[model samples]
Target chain A: MGDTFRDEELLADVICRLIGDVRHVAVGAQSPIPATAALLAQARGGGSPYVSLLGSRAHTFFTDGARELFDCAGQGRVDVFFLSGGQIDSEGNINLVSVGDYAHPKARFPGSFGSAYLYYVVPKVILFRTEHSRRTLVPKVDFVSAPGGSPGNVYRSGGPIGLVTNRCLFDFDRARRRFRLASVHPGHGVAEVIDNTGFDFDRPTHVPVTPAPSAETLALLRTTVAPMLAEVYPEFVKRVFNVPAPSP
Target chain B: MPLIAQSLDEALAPIAGGRLLAVPRESSGVAMAATRALIRRGIKRLHLVTLPTSSLQADLLIGAGCIETLETSAVSLGEFGPAPRFVAAILSGAIKMRDATCPALHAQLQAAEKGVPFMPLRGLLGSDVLAHRPDWKTIDNPFGNNDPIVLLPALTPDVALFHAPMADRAGNVFIGTQRELVVMAHAAQRTIVTVEKIHDGDLLRDPRLAAGTLAGFYVEAIAVSPRGAWPLPLPDHYGIDAAHMAEYARLAATPEGFAQYLDRYVYEKRAA
Candidate 1:
């Protein structure tokens, strides 16, 4: 929001809408935004039945005895899963592990956690990326950690369904399992979205601009949440949000 | 006690036979030393919990084939013998991956630690991946009459092991981050702990640092080795020895190789 609703509002709106009436979600390691979103949802009265968290980094608050966020994938217990990727294939598969080979590679990307089991097991796979660049939206993934569409003309389920980037939000056609253009965040256009993706897909008449964040939501997030996180992870305040550390 | 050798072979003398060993990735002194012992003992199956430093050590073990990795997500792919590091060596069929934030996973693990069966999540339905996965079966909602419900199976582990920055001789562990470690301890049947230095009243001083998910009775054994969890955890008293880790990673390739490496380092090099 350049001048409109604040960034926090936007985040809150996206999450509130995403977690509608579903129960049980499986989350992985290296997840901060998703965790924040889920915690925010619970804080805001959208109570989820259970949660499953991944990632092995142990901290007092980060790793304190949390488990059973979901049943298995199908039980409707685990519906929402969040992850980020270094590369995304046209078919919606993500690659975070490596670039060229296993032993030695050009650049070593983060590997997929539960991408094999949970991606195959969980119900809904939601992807979040910071920026939508061609480097990110690729024609083909260097490695297919999780298969999206089967070979030619094969029907499939349980693959990536949605991708939410800083620029736009997209959903795939269940049949062909190809990305069909959806809404682009406000002030952004279909052109910007297209320029970011590596491959071509069906074009919508016009992509809707994402709604601006509300004012009330912004105050709570900035006044409360940001301050708390900053106290613990000052670096997060500086890097991820690009804001200077406030008085703590 | 056969001279009470400090070698892993001698230290890990008590536990009965179980293939899969689960532990957190953080650099807890006890688990770290025990993992070192396990590596030295040639324990084959290893399931790791999330720790900031576990990924690096997990890679070292994977490269060595000392443990068959149960779960893995690559953060940075480094070089291994001919193969690239962080590659998903196990290429199974694809599944619908639930995208969760790090914090969310922590909460879920908490729920598991508490022994509650399931929790409901909002906002992930209608995802392409969620619609897939073989285990998920659809059933018509009895109340709604037509709408379908997505059902999931339960996931449980054999063991949960973790490292604590500090612990007592009686096995009270202390931690800084209240991550999902408590949940992991509760979720598993038996837990093994390793610590950096055992003090008399540290955990009791700050009970908040302990994962109350399970009482002290749940812990099977506690090992107190300073700098036990290196790299992942650089306890205030100690720091990570990068050269030692690099050499250790290189040497810990096989049971025989580890034995030879141990003979040089743990066995003949130093007397416990």
Candidate 2:
């Protein structure tokens, strides 16, 4: 993987840019792309933003157990966090519970972990879903594990800043409670996104293609970030980066 | 003195049928040995409360028909894929599911530890999780103007169970950085533990060991079962058995396969 980058790498680069210059970034379990992005951000920022990868001994700073992550988020120490859903609506509502009815239904995803709370507390909660289609980006979510926007009376410090998918990138306007098409990824166009999307979104006359990862970023990811990621996500690194698993 | 049981069954005697049993997350020491014993004994109607989330442990119990109610943040097999049993149970309405976010579970347990009726949490203002949970309430912040926050009722389980690296004869358990065990012990009516080994010396007497030690006062019983958290990691002690987990995910996909798995791994007594 010399000059060219995989879709995962491109997604990671985009998420890393979304992470920006935060004080701390927390990546949850089963999120290899977001984890890669956080690590990349840390490498680029010279370790300014503390990266906490849950279930990794080396990456996390919290010694107070699983609860510490939530407590730290509550205190406003965590700046960036990632959340995904089985179904996401145009308004930014995410559903992680079930597909059809609450009592009885069709498909059922894993229950919400910390999205109900973390989506409200973490300053920049980036919504990410690898699958971008009518099935995932629905007109309305069956259940709101966490809402994209809350009323004024509710205490909310943070919410979805934007949503990134394999097809395109969309920026969420909190006040307007809608998503605007930012740009389509390489080899993808505005019509493809609109055709696949379940809900309507605003797009300019000319939507640019998402930028690919730079050579410097790809080099850093392959050399430095790949090794660090192997600690938590061995299989992902092995498959994506072609790095062999170390002998136990 | 710690009530050191001779066998895993006796160590789990207090966790009777229909009792509320609280367990820790996967990375934290999971009492897999004891869980198997419970299944072998045909334990039923247990209201299982995962401190925050769980994986294979919960899946096995649910598949075995041991759980009547499950209160947890989420249950997944991590990299292995979706927890097949858990998903099936929810879709079939096999058990009562009380969906909660991660922090809400922690706050409720903290409330019980402090002997409070309820604890105020920041989120869950508009989610369906709050709507489904009739017990949880939203209250205006008396301290602030027009501020509303969710209140979670204190959750005190009948017993808290887990596995640890070691425990002293005096019953003090060394949990290292897994401080959530301490919280579970504080909130539960009784705490039962299985250890890989029993240290000869008193755990609380040593300054180095004392900080990470859960005093015998909270631990009701202890049993020695090496590799008690097998298939799951014991943090510093061992890494997860990925191959075994993948096998389990494949085998536990259907009811017949799950029963077959139980017969092979759970019911049989294999040498460690």
Best candidate, DockQ-wise? Answer: 2
Candidate 1 scores a chain A TM-score of 0.76
Model 1 earns a TM-score of 0.57
Residue-level lDDT tens digits of model 2 in A1-248: 24888899999999999999889999987889999999999999988789999988889999898999999999999999999999999999999999999999799888899999999999999999999999999999999999999999888899999999999899999999999999899878888899999998888888888989999999999999999998777778998999976432
Residues B158-194, candidate 1, lDDT per residue (tens digit)?
6666666665655655655433455566666656665
DockQ of 1: 0.14
Candidate lDDT scores, in order, read: 0.51, 0.92
Runs with alpha carbons beyond 4 Å of true place in candidate 2: A246-248, B270-272
Colliding pairs, model 2:
none
Q: On residues B1-272, what C-alpha lDDT tens digit does candidate 2 reach at each position?
A: 66999998888889999999999999899999899999988999999999899999999999999999999999999888899999999999999999999999999999999999999999898999999999999888989999988889999999999999999888999998899999999999999999999999988888988889999999999999999999888888888887888899999998989888998998886524
Looking at candidate 2 chain A, the ten consecutive residues that score lowest on lDDT are A239-248
